[model samples]
Target: MILANNLTKTYGNQIAVDQLNLDIPQGQFFGLIGPNGSGKTTSIHMLSTLLQATSGSITINGLDVTAHPQQVRRDIGLVFQESALDRMLSIEENLYFCAGLHGINKSAIKTRINSLLDLFELQSKKRASVGSLSGGMRRAVDIIRGVLHSPKVLFLDEPTVGLDLPSRRRIWRFIRNLIDDHKLTVVLTTHYLEEAAPCDNVAFIKLGKLVSEGSPEELIEQLGKTIVEVSGSNAEDYIKTLKLSAEDYMLDGRTLLIRVHKPQPNQVEQIQATLRDSADIISVRKSNLNDVFIWLSSKGQGTS
Candidate 1:
């Protein structure tokens, strides 16, 4: 569990995070999303006790992060964006070393390592050097090392930022399974729209302020639109023709977004038939998380 009230962080004149309040319940997968340099990492650092909040309170499992930093560290496992693995060490060796650092007994360390190797499907690569592992394998090992002590909260900063599609999906599965099996509360910061869209809750950060927070569905329902965007050469003129009913339309540059008043029989056919007069319609697609982000960013005062 994590609770932060008006958490603020300042680096001289630049405010990295400001009055960010968040509550992540036990076993919940929470996502912190924002564009580049939007204070996501700064917020995570404060919540994980890596950085001190300038003017707010953070409590993890009933203990204040600033007052009991050591205890907070014990309760949280942090996996940063950059790989922190010892490339020279073997997969098992790295986990073993991390366990030992956490004061786990040698007997228990071996058992824990074995368990993680099995769970992460790294048993066959136990003896393989970290540098020799694939990107996904190395990332998996990094995560295992972070959770070696079975911390209650997991802080993952851009967990799947640079991985290929397969590797990213694999990590997503691993993260979801870990939370479900261990009942771990996760605080994740990522820019990937797909990644954040699946989280139990999402908090949007912009220029250090907490701009928006809600479940993906709640956000979509609140700010997103059922966008029917038709691409064609006459997008502008077609939009003007639809302008008499302008209250139901939105234009983002070249995209013509029309809100459906209600479902009509053969709606797709009618919409296309209307567009056939002026333009050769190319595509029509539904709205997604990116649309929600766009709407929130447009209304929020904070910078991306």
Candidate 2:
């Protein structure tokens, strides 16, 4: 379990994370999402004890983070957005060095490494240099390094950023197996909203403040049942022609997203007819996590 109370970090006049509070239960997958400058990384660093907070308090497993940083580090694993494995070393060597840092015995480290490598189907590449592996393979090795010591909480900061669809799915399957088998608490931050859809709980932040927190379904439910995506020129003009309220739609430069709480028959037909000549594309779809993200991001300074 983890708890953060009024957590805040400031750089003189600029506040990176302001009054952030989180209560993440054990064995839960929690997501912290926002736009480019939304301070997600700052919050993660403070929670992980890598960066100190200006004010407020954080505790993990009933121990104060600031007061027991050494013990806290022992109980947590962090895989950064960047690769942490040394390019020159073999996968086995990288994991060996990391396990040794945690005071793991040589025999135990070898056994543990073997089991994890086998689980990920990387047993054959144990002796291969990290630099020789593909991006996805290297990322798998990084993940192995993070959990090699069997930490309680794992922080995955964009763990599947640039991987292809297949690679991303493979990585997630491995992550799910680990969480299910070990009951590991996972804290994730990623640009991909679809990935956050599987999380147990998710929180959206903007301008260093918490905007909303709930299950993916709960957040998406706030928007209506169906969403009409209208891709056309001068989208603002279409909204006026449609005679919709301000809250019923979101207008981007050339795309207009209209939220329909109650689906009336022929609504899409009517819109198509109205914009048959002006619109380039028109489609009706269900509300999703991306819509929730847009709804939140539109409130503040950024959009991811």
Candidate 3:
């Protein structure tokens, strides 16, 4: 449902996004993730028709984003970090106002609002003022408002930021349900890597360039199957002396993360026993996308 080829964005001599190439199919949940100032937002904005690209072309649902922006906008939904609803307005009122702005049929507005409110399990609270709802509910309402028009593509940029783990999980359940029911294609960007662990595909942005893109499973597998986390007060000293046959490793402050190439039985146990005296905390678990992210960032210019 989305296509971006060599999409470039710049400010004078500073390139914000460099030759980004993506092909996100319909109904796919795709993630654009990276450290701060890595152009994830810029890439999404260009895809959503909010910002124009400096070079190359983009198409959303086969509509040229630059040439047919108005039509493209009709097929896209965007929910950013900030709440789009008025704090004082009732949830029902807020959704109605947004639906009207989207030019949704007046005949279908109330039905749509009711259906979405029910789906998010906020029907009883629909009459309550938005300000009175919890943060999670408010974010849910934001997602509802974005989909009020039933846009084919949704752009979520840090939509769950600042929410606690439970709240984030709740919001994700809502999003996944929406995708399942409506086949809504999602383009999400968030600092919470675990939240994106279930994405159909993910693209990693680094230094405003595409460093890696693949399914989360593929990324984790490519990095390694086993990850060793070593922490101690004398972490620097431990890092200097540590020796292990591994694909790669990264040091984060006092935490040393090691990715073992192909873990063998009892490998973690032996490693832990070997480091028992030197480290304060040593543990091992299956590698995940977070490991891949840290590995990628370490190989690039330090993330901002």
Candidate 4:
């Protein structure tokens, strides 16, 4: 239950977000993705009432964000890309400070903190200093701080940026459980495309504008059912022999990606056999979110 209409943000003569519009339904796992400086964060800041939009309208749960920022803040949680915890403080202490800021009752704060720590399996580390924890643990604590007050919507900006694969998966598991248990709406922005594949809907932004929006599966389907990638010094030359249309392929340096719609097992076999000698590497697999992102980014900026 969030709506933004004609949202715009500018810095002097340069525009950071331009006439952006979005309508996120309740309990939806929505994703906002773009390259660096594509205005994803600027849009999030304006929507969260941390920064004001130059000209636009935003409403959360029927209240205008700009007109009623205080009320809006109470309905949302934010976990920034960077850590927001006080490193010197114990994990429990950092959560306590956040709960107080959100005005949770003194009596209920301890119970809330303990429940969250248990959920993330951080109960034993509650007494540990934040700086002493591993990167993954600190990030988990940051999320615990954000949702301590149980806000209806959670905004996560690059929540899994630097974590290892296992840690990232663990964080997503926690987030998924939170959403399922509490009916929380999550709005996420991440550079890791594969991590976003589970989102109900995702929007791509470029040059401060909406480039494309759809379910991850729907977007990837636009690429094709299968992706064939060939890489080597001769890859580009070899791709020309396939006689594929320009729209069916993308070339990035030594690698060439070709979209094969509804390819049969035999078709894949034939393609691989043809490239066996000419290419150093050849792979044929199901298309994925990264393929969709690369194709979209390539079309927008003339590069991948």
Best by the TM-score measure: 2
* Candidate scoring better on TM-score of 1 and 3: 3
Candidate 3 on 150-215: residue-level lDDT in tens? 899999999987677876777788788878998999999988898789899999998789988889
Q: Give the alpha-carbon lDDT of every model.
A: 0.80, 0.88, 0.85, 0.86
Q: Please provide, for model 2 over 10-121, each residue's C-alpha lDDT reduced to its tens digit, 9 standing for 90 to 100.
A: 9999999999999999899999999888889899999899999999999987889999998999999998989989999999999989988898977977888998899778
What's the TM-score of each model vs. the native?
0.85, 0.91, 0.87, 0.90
Q: Which stretches of candidate 4 lie over 4 Å from their true place?
A: 261-282, 301-304
Per-residue CA lDDT of model 1 for 1-304, tens digit only, reads: 8999999989999988988899889999999988788898888888888888889999999999999998788888989888888999998778878877778877877887887788768899999999999888888888888888989999999877668997788778877887899899998887788898888999888898878788988776655336567767767787666552544455676667664434446655666777876765535666677876765565464211
Error of 2 at 61 (Å): 1.1
Best by lDDT: 2
Q: RMSD for each model, in Å, please?
A: 3.7, 2.8, 3.3, 2.9
Task: Write candidate 4's Cα lDDT for 1-304 as tens digits.
Answer: 8899999999999999999999998899999998899999999999899999999999998899988998998999999878989999999888888878887866888887888788778999999999999988899899888888888899999998778998788789888987889889999999998878999999899989998888988777766778888898986677677766677788988988887764445766777888888889988889888888877777663221
Q: Give me the overall lDDT of model 2.
A: 0.88
Candidate 1 whole-model C-alpha lDDT, 0 to 1: 0.80
Query: In what order do the candidates fall by TM-score, top score first?
Result: 2, 4, 3, 1
Name the better of 1 and 3 by lDDT.
3
Instruction: Specify the poorest-scoring 10-residue window by lDDT in model 1.
Output: 295-304
Rank order (by lDDT, best first): 2, 4, 3, 1
